[model samples]
Target: MPRRHTPGHLPNDRLTELRSSVRERLGAPRPQSVHEHTPDSTHEQTTYSAQKQTHDSVRGPRTAVVIGRLLGLTFVLCFATGIWSHYLQDPLPWMRFPTRPAVLYQVTQGVHVAAGLASVPLLLAKLWTVYPRLFTWPPITSAIHALERGLTGVLVASSLLELTIGVMNIYHWYAWPFSFRTVHYALAWVIVGSLLAHIAFQLPTIRQHWRSRPSPRRGDAAVDVSEVDTGPAPIDRVQTDHVPADSVPADHVRTAGSDRRAFLASVAAASVAVVGFTAGQSTRFLSAFNLFGPRRYGDGPQGLPVNRTAAAADVLTTAADPAWTLEVRGNGIVHGFSRSELEAMDQSTEDIPIACVEGWSTSARWTGVRVRDVLTRSGIDPHSRLRVTSLQTRGGYAVSEMGPEFAADELTLIALGLNGEPLDLDHGYPARIIAPGRPGVLQTKWISTIEVIG
Candidate 1:
């Protein structure tokens, strides 16, 4: 007959026999109950099986819930920062930068981009934790699920498109129509709407889990090994070998169809978000590529100088030709100059921002003859108005008139090389206007004329 432990009453021989039997049944690294025994008595032992199951069962979702909350908080922060950067009416309280419109615009734009990038890793880990739930297709689903799916679809499409185009603009890739600007602007509101809806849907679950908190700390509790074994059972069948709590499968029970569907949805949403987030900034890298490749400025008519219309195709010429002429007409003054004569004047270089109406900006080194030099050479007063023309006859040539002081600002120049080398055809190769603090359209390309007036 098998003997059972009865605490203080068991004899030494019985205790020894029980210990041996328990070890054999439950395997080594044996469960020990730290019951105090008199110096004359055998040591007491308790099983660990019950304690182990209780630990695993209670801690599994608690860990997941904690991580989910952290990730959700991070997501909220990312979105909040982006919106604040874009639309907040006032500067952050402690920020030192003065609230000039252009300065604020650039600073907020940079902050928005930085925050967006940071979201990638955070959202990825969150998705990993939540993805398992997507596989479960819930029974008795309501209209809410349908609504969630629709919102998710919109978020995915809008996010991908916005990220792609926004990145392109930042890098100055103009292959696509600027119409993307209008579309992206409208879709931003839609994205905000969906994000709000998502948060609302999750609020109940978030609050419920927060209210019912569980301990995250792991304790060194002894397991109840006896629960695993019936009398005379082999150790392997009775109990599992010790494994790390973290490695244990989260869901021992089979997942329902609804649960599986939920897991899949989470995965799909996360995958799209991370992919779009990462690929969206390729254009930034591309923009920086041109910075070191060539120098773009040179001696020429500067400011809004007009020139004869060349064949639009020839506007995309490579290697400067001696035939280049600048047309300047303003204040009843019309004059033309050979490329060599303009080059003979005092030349200088400037690093200036080329801002486009489409909302991109680039800094390039512009080496060129000053607008003052061209005006002085033509016997035209710097105070005279100017109109610049382009070789492309279809679009009316860009026009801007400025007084002597603004025209002669050191930041303004007519550029020949883009970064460090001569301009590439795609970027107005042979002499283009590059004025600082002005829209890109105001900078005429394919220089054929600069018409100036007194």
Candidate 2:
């Protein structure tokens, strides 16, 4: 109202003077038109708001470091236990698994499953703590940077998939078309490899930000004044300010350190709960606490949990048939044993636990003829490697191998009874292999044939 301002009609000297004055007042290096300033100003406001929001809510590097360390430790334990289980199931020629510790498999597999389950919460917490990094402004700055992000993505995906399928496998669920064992085994290596690469890439950043420190706040003297004058600053130096007492309730305030500690504590509590809920399946003493566990101790036939029942294996009719005979073949010699004939032979009793790969185990008094005795009776060398075949025509574990050491173990038996009763059809019926320190799957059920390969 005081004076009318002309646009293009202004003198060049006047326009230059005006631009200089405006630049001086705003601390900008250059003058912009109203149209140019409007969009730029709006964009800067939006960016500042977003940065402020991120600074206030996103977890600091300290939180990521702590959670990441915990996650790494848990993953290491899970990986070691998982490798042991895999080797026990499919051992290499040079590897010899111990047979003395009767409960070794039970304990190891139990720890494996429990550790894997507990890692679920830990992994989620770690991912959440570092989630803001996914939105890093310059997503790709160079080839190495692009490779680092790609590896991180692979690590996340593979870890999640491996854990998902492992839990599903414990529940006896197969939803994927690919072989669960093969894929799960292979993805474990990928997860570990990617994790190593990710750690290498982030090691410097992790070391720099591992310790918590007092951060500057908005309007604080510690903040760079030049940044404030510039309007929108990079998020790296952004700080959250405390609300004024008159503007917001004091009780609503939360310190960053306290929030980080609370989040970590919650994750720890979740892991504990998960382990407590699932570890009971293997530790019989703690079974009552495992309400969420897949299998209960004594929930199946003859006080033993059955992972695959006769009906599920489609062997009910075949296994229950009166003419069913166990065929034992060795070096050009074949011998068949009828149920009565096998029972009429010397029956010995030994307490053996059926430790399954699914992480459930139950100890029972098993009565049967010694495997060595059967091999001797059949005129076969008990020292030779043997293959035990199940009556079930279908399933991945229909046939399992017995190393010479396992076959020669005196405790190994073609069990005919459990807990002083005739074996339930679901409990491998007439005869099933029960070897000390062997996986339940390797203790082949519904024995239809035993072929000595060497």
Give lDDT: candidate 1, residue 204. 45
- What's the TM for model 1? 0.42
Error of 2 at 10 (Å): 47
Clashes per candidate (backbone, < 3 Å): 70, 0
Provide the TM-score for each candidate, comma-separated: 0.42, 0.78
| Cα lDDT, model 1, residue 313 | 40
lDDT of 1 by residue, 1-454 (tens): 1124222222222223334444445654432322323221211211122222212222223333444554444445445544543332222433222222322332334334433443444345444444333432331145766687678668657655665665555445656765754565576677678767766765544543453333222221112223322212223222223434343223332232234345535544654454344332222443333332111222122311122233444543322465667776655666776656656667787766543433334445667777766766677776544556655545443444443443555545656656566655545656777765444555666666666532
Whole-model lDDT per candidate:
0.45, 0.74
Question: After TM-score superposition, what is the CA distance of residue 318 in candidate 2 from its true location, in Å?
Answer: 2.4
lDDT of 1 at 115: 38
Which parts of model 1 are misplaced by more than 4 Å? Answer: 1-149, 164-186, 200-321, 328-338, 344-346, 353-364, 370-389, 392-409, 416-429, 436-445, 448-454
